[model samples]
Target: MMKTTSIIASLLILSATTFAQSWTVDKVHSRLGYGVTHMGISESEGSFKDYTAKITSSKEDFSDAVVELTANVASINTENEQRDGHLKSPDFFDAAKYPTLTFKSTSFKKVGDKQYKVTGDLTLHGVTKPVTLDVVLNGTTTNPMSKKTVAGFKITGTIKRADFGVAAGMPTAMLGDEVAIRANTEFIKD
Candidate 1:
């Protein structure tokens, strides 16, 4: 009886570990970008230079994946020093008060082939709201140099700055209320 129990316990442990897989972002190959209309004429683009993201899943297709991300608000870079500084001020993200913005997925549902709808709670500027983003699995492959399994994903969505009280007082004419998000990320299995 004791030997049989030990064998069963070992199998259970092996199965549990085998099923749950974790992946970490390959930061060098990833980008978290955003865009906003400027003066109703052109678009201004920016990106957070510092952030961390992870993916956890138990299924091969990633149908049961959970994603989490955190970005430093002070790392906003628009290529212009003055604009970047202004964005970190109270008029926008208020980086001093709210140093980080985060997202935790509530659901990751496969909508079609290699496509999914990810719904999550986004916390920014001291406010939290549910936002849905569209995600496409670009591809998955084994890296020749690293010999590690990697997955590529593209995510796109829009969120209203007012919804998170970011630049609440700014007029839509000067800076569009809607902010467009585009993220291309590569995750390597651990």
Candidate 2:
């Protein structure tokens, strides 16, 4: 009876350790940013100061990973106080009403040696829509200080602001309809 119980416990431990590894964003080494053309001339850029993201995978190559992220709209920063305030108002994100934007991956498919196509539902400005993003796995390594496994990725995509009812009255000549999204993220195994 003792030997049988030991065998069962070992199996359970092995299964748990081998499947469903969870990774969390290392906030200090990650950034979520966006860019939009201003007045059809120069590009305006901004970034969210607060966000949370997680990745889950059972495969070593992260070919079958699922990613989910949430960012606080109020944390938008463009280094300009007035513009940031306006973005938080009803004209744009309406941070008071929406509070946050989110993304949850529906499909994560490996497209190349270190590239992936991630399709997910993005909820922003009180609207939910499907969006696809390209992800490039920079690499994975062990952190010298913590001795923990860490993975780096870069994600890029573009979304139409009008589709999500963000700044519906804004014209393309003033603020470009397409917002370019980019994020450089580092995830630590948990």
Candidate with top TM-score is 1
Cα-based TM-score, every candidate: 0.92, 0.91
Q: What ranges in model 2 sit over 4 Å off?
A: 1-18
RMSD of each: 2.7, 3.7
Off by over 4 Å in 1: 1-17
Q: What is candidate 1's lDDT per residue for 43-146, written digit by digit as tens?
A: 99999999999999988888889999999999999999999999999999999999999999999999999999999999999999999999999989999999
lDDT string for model 2 (66-168, tens) is 9999999999999999999999999999999999999999999999999999999999999999999999999999999999999999999999999999999
What lDDT score belongs to each candidate, Candidate 1 first? 0.96, 0.96
